[model samples]
Target: MTNLLLLIPVAIGLGLLGLFAFVWTLRSGQYDDLDGAAERILHEDDEY
Candidate 1:
């Protein structure tokens, strides 16, 4: 159908966008502190 032609490109574009964002996050250190964040929640600052 004609709708499929339009939707296919949109879906591919979205997939590519998601991939780019994932790569960007890796390069930006977004996931660098995976374990630290979890441990941090269990910690309390002495000042508090």
Candidate 2:
């Protein structure tokens, strides 16, 4: 029971931290181009 007292706050803090990070990414445009990497690799700028 003693361990639970300390663990609950730690768990809540970690969950909040993760939520903040995800929100930050959303605001920073980190998810703007989900398919860009895969689609970009199929195109080439070099001439054969």
Candidate 3:
């Protein structure tokens, strides 16, 4: 019972932390260029 009390809060805290980090990434435009890398790789750059 004592272990459950400690572990429950720790698990909740970790879940919340992960949710916040995911939200931050969404707001920071991290997914805005999902296809950019694929498109860029197909184009060759002459500048070495």
Candidate 4:
């Protein structure tokens, strides 16, 4: 019973942390160029 008190908050905190990190990525344009990234890999750069 005592362990549940501690484990519950820890689990909730971890879940909230993950949610916030996901939201941050969305707002930071991390997913805005998903297709661009895939296509870019197929092209070659001219850099020496």
Candidate 5:
């Protein structure tokens, strides 16, 4: 019973941390060029 009291808040805190990280990624444009990234690998570049 005592373990649940401590573990529940810890779990919730971890979940919120994950949600914030995901939201941060969205705000940082991490998903903006999804298709571009997939197609970019197919094209060869002239960089030496």
Candidate 6:
């Protein structure tokens, strides 16, 4: 039962860390160009 006390905090901390990272990425515009990246991969360049 004592182990549950320790594991609960660790799990909560990890969840919070993941949430913070996701929010940080949102604020930093990390997902702004999602469609552009996909389209870019399909684009072809004409080089001779």
Best candidate, lDDT: 3
List, residue by residue over 1-48, the lDDT tens digit for candidate 4: 999999999999999999999999999999998799899999999998
lDDT of 5 by residue, 1-48 (tens): 999999999999999999999999999999998899889999999997
Worst 10 residues of 3 by lDDT: 28-37
Candidate 6 C-alpha lDDT tens digits along 1-48: 999999999999999999999999999999998899899889897875
Ranking by TM-score: 5, 4, 3, 1, 2, 6
**Runs off by more than 4 Å, candidate 3:** none
TM-score of 4: 0.91
- Alpha-carbon lDDT of model 5: 0.97
The better candidate by lDDT, 5 or 6, is 5
Better of 2 and 3 by lDDT: 3
Collision count for each candidate, in order: 0, 0, 0, 0, 0, 0
Which structure is stronger by TM-score: 3 or 5? 5
TM-score of each candidate?
A: 0.87, 0.86, 0.88, 0.91, 0.91, 0.85
Supply the TM-score for candidate 1.
Answer: 0.87
Model 3 residue-pair collision total:
0
- lDDT for model 1: 0.96
How large an RMSD does model 2 have? 2.0
CA lDDT of every candidate: 0.96, 0.97, 0.99, 0.97, 0.97, 0.96
Query: Candidate 1 lDDT, tens digit per residue, 1-48?
Result: 999999999999999999999999999999988899899889998985
- The regions of model 2 sitting more than 4 angstroms off are none
Displacement of the residue 19 alpha carbon in candidate 5, Å = 0.6
Q: Lowest summed-lDDT stretch of 10 residues in model 2?
A: 39-48
